[model samples]
Target: MPIIKSKIFTKSKKTSSFFITILFILSFLLVFINKADLYIGSKIKTVSADIASPIIYFLTFPFDKSISAIQNLNSLKNISIENNKLKEEIKILKQWQSLSLKLINENKAYKELLNVNDDTFETLETARVINKAPNIFANIIQLNIGLNKNIEINSGVLNERGLIGRIINIGNVTSRVLLITDINSSIPVKTLNQDINAIISGQSDSILLKLKFIKENKMPKIGEIIVTSGNADIFPPNIAVGKIYKIEDNIYYVKPFVNFKELEFVNVITKKL
Candidate 1:
């Protein structure tokens, strides 16, 4: 055992001594090179840079690429957040624009209603249309005002355009208005251009009104306006009703000035119950 230990120690000492001698020789050469030339120092620096450049690039290339990728991802995240905020702002602006349009239309309708200045009505009440649905009554509409507002039966109903319908049933808070388009509705009317009197009756399952009992001697022309004659004292005189658009087979179809689909507010102006 001791013999093997001594052999290992001798080999280690020889290896150490050889490295020390080589280092002493290199140190002496370094001093000689220092005195060699200023240009030699520059050449050594150039060679050292050539060798170290590739090693430095190899070490830093992956790190630089990783940093660039991370920066790009952060920029994309910021762009996404900004886009979401812009979308939300646009949505809110659109909602306000829609509401503004609705108000403008409603205001225009109200102005049209104000133009219906009737001087013959003893009682005038503004009513809101609550329901207009299809039923056994072909063209029936319900109003918000009824007996509570002293709304009378057989009273006249009109919109901004002209006379639309009449009141039939009166409740405490609501009333059933029989639209002029109903099959049973018949109004005594006279032509605007001529004094030809006739009964404007509603046709079954149709929106147009029919003129009946016109005197053979007085034939009215197309485009003549029709107004109430106040014969039965139900609808007042000179109240606008409809226009004669077409006349076929001795039957004249009158297109009412009131648009049933857009009838939102109305005026009930006549005698009360």
Candidate 2:
């Protein structure tokens, strides 16, 4: 029993010594880590900095690339949106420019009409065409002005180029114009070349006007200018009607300057009877 006790005590001492040696070794390692900068400061710092730099780069490289790609994508998207808006603006600007050009040309034509000085006809009031007859054969247009604006029945309607029609029906604020192309329309016109007076009758087409009541002794030649004669109380004299384009036997055909299909504005004469 005594020897067994002795062996047990010896093993305990050995174990205790082993634990003490382990604790000392751990203490020494902690001291070495804490004092490492002071002992080999410059060398250790340089080595650690170099190793840490690459490690940090490896850790952050993917995140940096992701952020850069996101920024680039956002910039591209903004540019695409802006470009689309600019294209729309450009399209609208082009439409406005075309409209402005059309207005300018119309204004010029109106100015030319104002400069005309035909003493036989009274002053004319410029009117805008508001509506057209559904059947072009009617050859009628509705004007903005009417009886309230001194427009009366038989008042002549003329455009910048030539005589267009006569006002047949007048309302309080609107008037209906009978185009020269109306089947019922007739104007006394004289040929510029031969001074032969003839009755120009309207057809369905404004481009074509028939010269009738032409004396057998006088035959009209092609390309002769035709003008309105003041003999008709409805229409003023010397108003440009058209030029003769075709002379088939005794009948003469004239092509008018005003295109009825594209009529926009007209002048209404308010003549005193």
Candidate 3:
């Protein structure tokens, strides 16, 4: 029994010494880490991270989750605002596209339909337009081109969009134009089909014109473009007049290609080459 007790005492002392040695080594490591340079500090940090990764993750998991939710909410709000702005932009673009479509159609490939004599008419001079003061619908408007123009009467006047009128009366200083919408104004126009030759007459005080003398067999369909027929050498051929819109009682109504309300400048067709 005495020998057994002695062996147990020896084992306990050895175990205590082993634990003390381990504690001293840990203390020395802590001190060394506190005084370590960048390289040694980085290595220690890597080892420390491996040891504390799970605890660190446990403490910050809730905060990371909250931040992600906030980011998602902000993203949703931004997406909503952006979607509204895009919708408004698309609406505005659609409106512009309608107006642009008319202009584009006039500029399109009309060569396949008719031989547009583009080089025949020479633009004489550009003149500033003076739309009658409170009456934009007034049939007569004055040109700001001062005296000394021997331009003949019935010379075609054109705006940027298309032909608007013809010079009706040339005075000493200013020239007056008979607008296309004037009741006395009439243009010989034809469609892509050469057989569909007809006359477009103004509606007195309206924006639309009347298509006259269209035979039953040569009636122009809605949306078909009409241009100057150059009949009797009065005006240049292929000058886009308007498009047929409505037909009632065998009378077809045309919408003028030229926007007269915005008439700011005009070019006078002097002569056909």
Candidate 4:
């Protein structure tokens, strides 16, 4: 009895598998028949597209979104990198703009200096300021041009703005300049409007020049333009010196046109006939 029951169970399992296979084959045949039938082919295809396409899309939706998200992340990172690079370039351009503006203003001043009236048999030699004493009281500077350039002792040194100093010591390839603001230095100056004569002298560490030799009864008015008087022959006559800044304690002071702290280049009078 037990053997018969086992055989029956095995037979039943095989029969069930055979029916499943047959059903699968029949389902495929039915689909192929519907596709081959001209009357039903279009209708069946339409139905499959409408129903199966949405089911397929739903199954793949998460994977497609993940790929799109990855692409978007890479694009954002690239944009950030490009933006930072642009910022650095803009900063450099701004610095260049500032430097260019300074040069432009300097050029305009040079044009005006060349237009000044002068009648002297002199040759101008341009030189760069190589060194300067920190103490304004010393008022000494060094130039790159020397005897080779025909630079002479007591020769007038000026720039586009006005007179800076005179060559006091000469060397083979360098020269020492004594600025007008030195204590031991003095230059004869005259007012442009009044023709009043005075001597402009420097005090230790002072930016203002002391006006001397004016009559006790005469006081120079404020804002009078002073020029070289050509008395000592150190500088040409009518060379710009400074303007009368103020008068106090029975002393008149003139402010020089050139700012000594920012001095860079100067023109040395190589010859004055």
* Candidate 1 C-alpha lDDT tens digits along 100-149: 98788777777767666756654367888899785433588899988889
In the range 129-169, model 2's lDDT, one tens digit per residue, is: 89987654658899998867877789888877888889989
Model 4 sits at a Cα RMSD from the real structure of 10.9
Every candidate's lDDT: 0.85, 0.83, 0.79, 0.83
Is candidate 2 or 3 superior in lDDT?
A: 2
lDDT of 3 at 177: 91
Model 3 gets an lDDT of: 0.79
Which clashing pairs does model 1 show?
none
Write candidate 4's Cα lDDT for 138-188 as tens digits.
589999999898778899888777888888999999999988998888998
TM-score of each: 0.65, 0.64, 0.55, 0.63
- Give residue 219's lDDT in candidate 1 (0 to 100): 85
User: Would you give me the overall lDDT of model 2?
Assistant: 0.83
**Total clashes, candidate 1?**
0
* Order of quality (TM-score): 1, 2, 4, 3
